[model samples]
Target: MQHRFLLGTRKGLFVVERTVHGWRSLPPHFPGLQIPAVLTDPRDGAWYAVVHHGHFGTKLHRSADSGRTWTEIASPAFPPKPADAPDIRCPMRGVTIPWSVELAWCLEAGGDDQTGRLWCGTVPGGLFKSDDHGDSWSLVTGLWNRPERAKWFGGGYDYPGIHSILVDPRDPTRLGVGVSCGGYWVSEDDGATWANRSDGMRAAYLPPDQADDPDTQDPHRISRCLAEPDVLWCQHHNGIFRSTDDGLSWKAVPPPEPSGFGFAVAAHPIDPETALFAPAEADVCRIPKAGRFVLTRTRDGGKGFETLTRGLPLDEAYDLVYRHGIDTDATGNRVAVGSTSGGVWVSEDGGDGWMPLPVRFPPVLTVRFV
Candidate 1:
């Protein structure tokens, strides 16, 4: 079977196809527009892409024939400011803030049985839902109107955004989302109501006593095991974390060697005990730890992690993998990783080994197998 990979980059979106011989590249779809997120619906083979224009704002596009063509769709927008809407204040710092929706940070396909249903997470931290595929979208007001949102702050950007959305495969009504600088949230009733589930996560940048505060926790990225939705893996701002109760609570997981701080994490499609992470230095410097590139895999959950570096750069290499830049296929054996420096690599045997794709493109924002 042929494998298809979608590479979202700052300049556009590229399609990488792999055959028995090797990998082949297709022309970029949205040339010059920043493509932060893209997903292919397995239910009907529809493709979705998030296109962000600096001055024109962000938009969503869909393609039925893979990446050959696309149609722009209605994008998520914040509701008109209410007359009584008060300026939001940082919960911990007590600073008045002006928050507005600026971009769609992530896109996710719903459960296998929920055809045409889609989920979107956006900057300024809003969750949206679409029952008619990408044609129309509505803000999940239950999450937006939460009182806890008033305290959320941005981890990298000026405003916190939900960059990870996980729809429980076992139950379509259950959902989870991760926000930068904010915390993790779960909804058991199809997003009608939300609650913070970041119990054990920490925010090292905050006061020592405030480190464990849910609102102060920064979850860079979160991934769930397809085989066991209750198991989740997170690459947090301070370190790695794992949760066995569907994100109700989390525990710190030490990375293999250099550091545990990184942006991306991917769970094995079939094994709840396996996962992959791309490690980088802490917030002070986002390069590969100690100037060496490696991918760490844990087959026994967080009990132990092994570093996989063969076929990867060994010295003087500085590549930062974004939160959505690493992904594994349904088989759980094929893994693809993209770097912010326009480098791409693929591993057919899980994280055991890797091979670089022949050509380089723009700064990659995300990578996924369709």
Candidate 2:
């Protein structure tokens, strides 16, 4: 079987196919869209993409026949303005509606009875549920009306931003997501009410400026494993952590180095025991390992860590991988990583070594197998 890969970059959406001549890139599906997400919907056999749609906001497009044709889905629609706050009066504080959705899912893989519903996590951070497979979406009021959430968000009009949304593969109703300064939240009733899931997570790693508030306490950097639902893992600024009971509780998993923070974590699809992460010395600096680039791995569930940087660069490495920028192919044999430095590397032998892919894509944000 031939497996295609999609790369979402700041420039646009790129497709890579495996042919006799090796990997080749097709023309970007939406040029200059600032595409963030490119995913395949198993329910409708369609490819869905999210892109920045100019001043109007981010837009969602769907391709029914692979990447041939696309139709815009009515999303990124912000709520209406209240009578008290008119645009003309507050021209300096002009409010632009957010039309772009952050993350999208087909919900087919979610192990719930209610499959086929399209789910999206957006900025300004709220969950959107679509019953008609992404044709349209309605914001879930259950999460939007949380009384304590406002107070927890520092009483600001703009509380936080959502980066990752994970719907339990075994039970879709049970979902978990990570917010920039809001920590982590889980919903057991399929997008209804959510409870904070940051018991063992720490705020010690927060930067000097944001360390004064609740942002550090939040699980600012988090990721979930599909192979082991009970074993939820996150690579935060503080360190790494794993939950045995599916986010009910957590324990710290420190990296090899004490001063650095990790951004990306990739779990083995079949072998839950094996996982990979990229740790950088500085959050702003993208150079892997401060010029000594490395991808660390753990086989015994974070008990011990080892450096795996054979083919990666050690000098003048410009880009560092982000949280969502690393992933494993379906076969579980190949690992791929993208960087803010505008390069993509593939490791066929599990992180033993990595080689650059054929295409010269832009700073890659997320990579997924199709």
Candidate 3:
């Protein structure tokens, strides 16, 4: 069977189809702007893409009939501004010409029903919720206005800037959001309130000299996997951790190998005992050393790991994978990785062997198979 892949590109949105030979990219979905997130709903057969409009703010486009035609969903919660406002990032200078939406990104379409809810996260970020699909939205008051957050996470440098929003696939009311320096937060009552899940996380306030620069060190990142509501696979700069009692507590899972500068973590759709990740340097340039790419899987609940590098390119010495870019298919038999060097590799035999797809996508920012 052939599959359609929705690509959120730097310039615009594109669709890729699996042909008899390989994948092919279609024309741009919209005129200009970067598409940071795209969702292909298997249930309703709708396509939704979020566009970053620099300072002008963000836009959402939806197609009930696939990519044949489109319509824009004017953001309902976007803080209204004067006609010639500055930008989304800097809204003071009356900057008319739009600026590059500097990563004030959003991850849309979450919740149990998977049709009515969509969550958006932004830089200096605030959490916004939309229950009517993308028609309108409202800020999650508790998360957006945490009293102690400004002091706890540092207002300027350590403040919250969201990158990922995960709602329990099994129970959409329970929500989780991943922030840059603030770490992770969880909401049990459908985002009515949030609690920090960084208890086991290292919140080291490093001095300039003592700091492990994200560029040189592991960037002290945090990523999560929710294969089960009670069990979450979390990866941090220091090590890998597992939360058995939801996000309330955590236990450190021994690194599969010596190298643990992990960027992403993915749990198989059905196989709870199985998950995958890519290893890289902890510092600024987290490239794989000499294309030494390996897909590490833990079969016995992080007790032991097996490496799958069968068809992965071994020529380059360093093969690095970044955070938020690895994913598993519905059957869990196939896996794909997007590299900083702009490489895409797919494994159909459960990560034992990989097939290099035909398209050379831009340095892959994220990969999702649905």
Q: Which candidate achieves the best lDDT against the true structure?
A: 1
**TM-score attained by model 2:** 0.84
- Candidate 3 per-residue lDDT over residues 68-173, each given as its tens digit: 8888874535454456743332222222312122344556567546567777776555677777767887767688556434422311123345666776777888
lDDT (Cα atoms) of all candidates against the true structure: 0.88, 0.66, 0.62
RMSD of each: 1.5, 4.7, 5.9
lDDT of 3: 0.62
Candidate 3 residue 111 Cα shift, in angstroms, is 3.4
**Local lDDT at 295 for model 3:** 69
> Order the candidates by lDDT, highest first — what do you get?
1, 2, 3
Candidate numbers sorted by TM-score from highest down:
1, 2, 3
Better model by lDDT, 2 or 3? Answer: 2
> TM-scores for all candidates?
0.96, 0.84, 0.80
| Count of clashing residue pairs in every prediction | 1, 4, 23
Number of the top TM-score candidate: 1
Q: In angstroms, how far off is 113's CA in candidate 3?
A: 4.1
Please give the TM-score that candidate 1 achieves against the real structure: 0.96
What's the lDDT of the predicted structure labeled candidate 1? 0.88
lDDT of 2 by residue, 212-292 (tens): 343224444455566776777677656787777877777887666522466777777666667788877754554555476
- Candidate 1 lDDT, 1-370, residue by residue in tens: 2299999999999999987678777889889999999988888998999999989989999999987778999998767878887788766556654456688999988877877889999987889999899788888989988888887887767777899999998888899999987799999998999999999998878889888889768999999998988999999988999999999889998756777989999999889999999989777889998889888899998989898998898778788899999999998888999999888999989889898888778999999999
